[model samples]
Target: MRILAVDDDLHMLQFVAGELRQHGYEVISAENGEQALARLEQQTVDLAIVDVMMPGIDGFELTERIHTDYDIPVILLTARHHIEDKERGFLAGSDDYLVKPFESKELLFRVKAILRRYDHPANNTLTAGSLTIDLKSYELRSPNGLSFIPLKEFELLALLASKPRHVFTRDAIIESVWGLDFQGDEQTINVHIKRLRTRLEQFAPDVKIVTVRGVGYKLEADS
Candidate 1:
């Protein structure tokens, strides 16, 4: 992955760049936000690690610009540990934030986590016939209009949409949607699926969630 590290401090910039490079990431170092923007215009960056305090644009402005222009993930690095600073970073469209004097391992982990979430294959928008899912905005739209579904339900829909017309057992659905750490029973999966079906029906009344006799369920594109 290509990462752009923007900081005014030469030592800090070099340190972060070197550390990321050691982790098998392509590193691009910039002394200020302008340089970072220039680099971004020239190349495609997978992620950006931006320092809050810079010479011209600063981290907040840089994050805002990047988010406005590109949907790339950004991690804000700041010495200010206050909640206000963190909130400002988030408001400016930072995907994650880390306080300065952070451990290299922690920084690497945060970067990896944010990148993993940003590049999640299952998170891609899913569509089944007339039904549409905007994964980034978590918006579900059918032929009728938009429908409101909670996070878990949206995930369930995405998982089911990933493999349409295939019967997924109840146990398999629970494991895939709720995760192995989930202590809920198979009934929980059934309940969520029921709720999801109800919501989808409001948008596409013809949509069908098929049930096999002893097996689980399959989301059929058309009713």
Candidate 2:
């Protein structure tokens, strides 16, 4: 995927760009938000990583502009860990937030996760049998209209619905959805799958997320 990394600090910008490149992504570097905007005007980027502090056009404003102009997904990087900063980032159209001094692996994982979620074709809608997933709005409803799914539950459902009948090992599911950086164990995936199944039971009582004995989990669309 093509990514844009913008930061006033030349070293930081290069560092992030190099890291992303190492991960098999095409990366463009910019020294500030204005430069980043210029790059965007010339090329299409799958995602952008912007530092919050800059001399001209701070990260928030930059993110707002990108959202308004390109509808591009952005991941904000900031040294400031304040809750307010995070809230502002989201309000300004940042799809994700990463505090500075973050692990390279963590940064890569967040980038991949945000891009995956943003670009997921199954997002906003997915259908398997009578089940439907509203990924953009984080809602899942059944054909019978007897159930509602919460956000996390709906994420789990959407992940399964995207690849009908494909078995996803717990580790793979956690890495794909929760992200590789999530510290939770395989049991977390199990719990969410259980809850998702409970909600799905209301509409398609026979449809289920099945455990493969010693293998993993699979969504049984025909069940």
Runs of candidate 2 with Cα error greater than 4 angstroms are 123-223
lDDT of 2 by residue, 99-184 (tens): 88988999988988888777755436877777776656665566677456666667677766666665566665676678769987
- Residue 176 lDDT, candidate 2, scale 0-100: 66
lDDT per residue, candidate 1, 1-223, as tens digits?
8899999998999989999999999998899999998887555577999999998899999999988765588999999979999999999999999888999999999999988886676555877878888878888887688777788988888766755665666766776778768887777877887888787777866666887768777777754
Please report, in order, the local distance difference test score of every candidate based on alpha carbons.
0.83, 0.80
- Which residue pairs does candidate 1 place in steric collision? none
Q: List the residue pairs that clash in candidate 2.
A: 124-136
Backbone clash total for model 1 is: 0
